[model samples]
Target: ALLGDAAHPMRPYLAQGAGMAIEDAQALAQCLSVGNAMVPEQLQAYAQARWARNARVQARAIRNGRIFHAQGAVALGRNLSMRLMGERLMDVPWLYAGGSEVHGFNGNAL
Candidate 1:
């Protein structure tokens, strides 16, 4: 199965490419460790485990690219929001949590 950039091809705005690749390896490892499943099934399981989180990260990266590259009123708003919220505005709890809720793999949440 495709993994990391091959799978998602995200921009660097979120700085998640390496992290996502590591996560992909972990999920793929977990899938391959399943005793009963065939290789095809394991690969499918890996896809199921990773797809949504990867998609979310990719989308967020795109949004961050726009935000980082904003100009005029958008840039002003972005700066104002940053000033008001500080780093809390950049907090991504779901992502930081390793998306366990979305990854019920090997009888354990990722």
Candidate 2:
């Protein structure tokens, strides 16, 4: 399966491209380890498992770019929110922590 830039090329705003690539490799390895499925079936399963999560990450990266490039009042508000929330605002538990249910995969490796 495609990993890193081959799978989803995203902006560096979220700093997750490399991390996602690593996760993709791990997930793909796990999918391949199943051993019962054909190559095409395994790949389809990998795509199904990763599509949503990758899409979300890509979208977040784009959104973060916009937020980071914000000007005037928007920038002011963004800075204020960051200050108010501190590390909590930047901490994405769902993205970092596992437990997401992806089709064709039963592990929390992602």
Candidate 3:
């Protein structure tokens, strides 16, 4: 099965490529660890668990790339928003935290 950049190539906007690769490895390991599960079942489980998360990250990365490369009024508005709520915009607790237990993975709480 494809994993890492081969599975989900994304722009560097969010700087999450390596992190996602690591996560993919961990998830694959966990899925494979299930003793009675067939190879196809494990692969399916891994894909089902990771596809949505990877897709979301890929979409966010594309959006962030657009924002970063924006010009004119769009750039102005983005800058204004950043100035007004930079900290809130920068903080991604849901992306950096949550959802580990759902997959039976012990990821960092950060």
Candidate number with greatest lDDT:
1
TM-score of candidate 2 against the unseen true structure: 0.85
Best by TM-score: 1
Q: Could you give the C-alpha RMSD of every candidate to the true structure, in order shown?
A: 2.3, 3.0, 4.3
Ordered list by TM-score, greatest first: 1, 3, 2
How high is each candidate's TM-score?
0.89, 0.85, 0.87
| lDDT-best of 1 and 3 | 1
lDDT of 2 by residue, 30-103 (tens): 67767666888778777777888888989998999999999999999999999999889777787888424444
Model 3 C-alpha RMSD vs. true structure (Å) is: 4.3
lDDT of 3 by residue, 27-84 (tens): 8887787776688977887887788888888999999999999999999999999999
The C-alpha stretches of model 1 lying farther than 4 A from their native spots are 101-110
Residue pairs in collision within model 2: none
Give lDDT per model, in order. 0.85, 0.79, 0.79
TM-score of decoy 1: 0.89
Q: Model 3, 50: alpha-carbon shift in Å? A: 0.4
Candidate 3, after superposition: displacement of residue 62 in Å?
0.3
The weakest ten consecutive residues by lDDT in model 2 span 99-108
- Cα deviation of 108 in candidate 2 (Å)? 12
